[model samples]
Target: MKRVAILVETALASGRNILAGISQYIREHDDWSVFHPTGYMGATDIAGLVDWDGDGIIARISDPAILKNLKAKNTHIVDVLGNVQKSPFPLVKCDDRKIGRMVAEHFIGNGHRHFAFLGFSSERWSFERQEAFGQSLEKEHGQVSLCHLNPRHQGPAHWHRNLDHVASWVEGLPKPCAMLVASDQFGPLAMKACERSGISIPEEISIVGVDNDQSFCELCRPQLSSIEPNHTRVGYEAARLLDALITDERTSETLLETPPLSLYTRGSSDTMAVSDPALVKAMRFIRQEACNGISVDHVAESAGVSRSVLQRRFKDQLGRTVGDIILSVKLRRARDMLAFTKISIPEIAERSGFNYQEYLNYIFKKHLSTTPVRFREEAGR
Candidate 1:
């Protein structure tokens, strides 16, 4: 069997999931066995490393000195993290700019005027997200304030700690503001800062983060909303590229992998309206009970509004009818399940509030231009 070395440290659930998806893809159809080294070492260790013949390597590190020292020019190198700016090997990475724009658009769509961004002090991804977010806001004729937390900033020890700075910044922003944290870890941190400062989520302030790590999001009091970066696709594509290199199938100078960004709506950033209360309530009902076979009448009745009036109001405000809004919500739910869960098509359809599998397929194709199976496959399941 062909072998590949995997060097990774600072493992998180998101990273593990990415690798797991890649591993699954490789295991079923290939003769490759993955090897993991103990820890991340820079140029020093790479220079002295001795290795038996293996096809290639997939790694998160992209330090120039390290890759150069490894002296494995003949071995195919797949860089999944995109840390290496320029490399001879193929590269796969989360669509950071799209993620930033997605979060910005989502916040603006929900009727947020004042905005804020919380992220690491200095990082490439952070800069990318900030730039994209600012650009999107400008395109929408809006603006956002930014508060960066230095990586070296100690918690509470330094008077200028990230959380303290963030809390101060949040206190200054106008009410009903939406803040996007760069990473999932910072979501809860930002929330805690809000709690300490007497700020309420989605009411006084709204928040979103990148990386849809369930354990991290669910653990927060008001479950965090996040952007799912399609890490699984990144892994799957990385594996495919590595396999090609292993077999000497193709020799491309550089390969870039891009995936669509998806939003995982949750409590922290679930505000559906500021202009109309009834519409927001109705939309919330549709989102919650779409899987329970709810209808327009049901949503109207639940929101204490007449069906005709609700329909007119929804159309006027959202540019879509109440029924269409419900369908959109159902489709989005179905799409999320198809991408994240291992459920069958029938189950996914039902869970997403579709009457039948064929209906799900039809609507999925109509709206998303893809079948459920294809979505899962592309999602790296």
Candidate 2:
């Protein structure tokens, strides 16, 4: 049997998901003797890792101590945690840049004209994510306000300081802005800051985070929306690469980036950044009920307004009529399904509230200037 050490933490969903993937690989191979610790990587575990003469190691390497210990190991090593930009070992981690771009597209699609990115300054992955997010958002929005919450002392005082700083930073930004936090761990911190600042979420501010840590996301007043990085795939790829290196099977020492799975929408970011409450209500109603072949009248009734009033509001606020908004929403849904799924064109039309495939083609040509198939092909690249 091959001895392998897993130095990833067990406290977070990301780490656990990586472990789950490793477990799956080991079960299939039945040759790995894993040396994973019981909880978070501590001093004792680090010592144990130093003592163990494993054939290979897969580690987050967030702590310098872990890196130092790992460097001393004369074995094949895979670093899953992307804390360093250039490292001695091959990296198997999430595509943080793509994650940022995805979240930026999400917020931009939801009509956010202003954006902010919050993250830790010490982490290379966090910085990379923030850079990609700012660049993507700034192309259309002109400028993205950036903030970094660096590591500080462990206490309630520092926590309160962070809250105050975030509250101040957010309060100064333009209203109806979307905030893309670096991770779910900071989601609640931002939410708490908003609570302190009395800024309503998804109205004055919409927040999206990375790593779909459900427990942290759900614990917030309005649940957080996050990008689900495929850590399981990362771990599997890591194991495959490590096995190749262990057996001297000609493995390349380079970084492998696993693309994110999907964005999990939640209460925190499931709204447009519009100021009009009536328009917001109408839009939400249409989004939830549009697939049922709802019309402008249905939208008006849902928002408790006359058709004419709703139309005027839509024109004034969004420069689009009620019918136009409904169609655009339908088109967006259809486009997302096309890019992400293998559903047929006819079924996609039916699901996206288009009555016929011919109509979907016509709309795509008119509004999107491309056929559904072509769009899917382009999106795949």
Candidate 3:
């Protein structure tokens, strides 16, 4: 029997999802006793890990002393938390660089010329995301305004002051700007900043954050758009690495970055940065009702414009017709569900406003260059 210490915290959805992946690994194997720490555990607590005697251990930790102790104990370790820059254990983490580039391309595709990034100066992960975002924009001959806060100083006074600085940054940003936050936790903070400046979202400023923390994303005033990192794949791959180490079949791989699932759009970034009232209204209408089988005529009527006018305006401003925008919205919804949920293809088709499963397949192939099932497979891994 292989006694394994699974010292992963379950406080956030990401952590819990990692545990789910580990659980999957255990189910496929035999005689593996899993010991997982539950509830709250303090950082830098050696006892939380040292008390357990296991043949192999998989933990998301950062304290150097703890790492030294684990190394002395000679148990296999796989570090999922990449916050520690140089740990002896192998690492399995999300690709923050890819996530950053993905968000940049999203904003650029939506016709956003002005951009900004919200993050913590204290965190290495945040810095990495910010750098990647900047590089991607530079490739497109664009740049971003940066507002990074350091949360090392704890207190209400410090938090409020940070919020104020964020507000000041927002107030100074160019109009019709698109902002990318390092994580979903800070999405609402930026939104609050916007509120302080009396700025409207998806009109003056559109926000997209990384790490699609559902609670943070949904609870925001306009709901947040965020990049969904594949937490399950991180855990699953970490467990696999640990298993390999346990079996004395360790390869040269020391760090493996799991790819992001997809960017889920919500009210925060559902519209383009355009000033045409009719075009904006048409976009708003299409985003809301596109999955309800609405057509270009319906979108035109909702915008109080004729179909010809709406299509012409869409091409002028968004470089696409009304039908393209409608199809894009529907595809985004379908893609989100495919990557994040277990909804069936037929059900996804109906919910995405497709008349039949075959039509959904046709659209997926014609647009995404792959079938829905294949997309799900790639996203899941």
From the highest TM-score down, the ranking of the candidates is 2, 3, 1
What TM-score, over all chains together, does every model reach? 0.67, 0.74, 0.74
Candidate 1 residue lDDT tens string, 206-227: 8898888877787775678898
lDDT, candidates in the order shown? 0.74, 0.83, 0.83
Model 1 residue 252 CA deviation (Å) reads 3.1
lDDT of 3 at 192: 94
Instruction: List the candidates ranked by lDDT, beginning with the highest.
Output: 2, 3, 1
lDDT, candidate 2, 1-381, per-residue tens:
888988888667888888888888888888888887655332225666646887998888775666777788878899998785557889999999999999999999888998998888788779878888989977668888887887654246689778878889988988788999998988989999888887777667899998889778878756788999999998898998888888889866588999999999876887667877777678767766777899899999988999999999888777788888678668867876786679998999999999799999999999989998899899782
The residue pairs that clash in candidate 2, if any, are 202-205
Write one digit per residue (lDDT tens) for candidate 3, span 178-279. 999998878888999999898778767899988788888878867799999888889889888888888899499899998899998887997778977777
Q: Using TM-score as the measure, name the better of candidate 1 and candidate 2.
A: 2
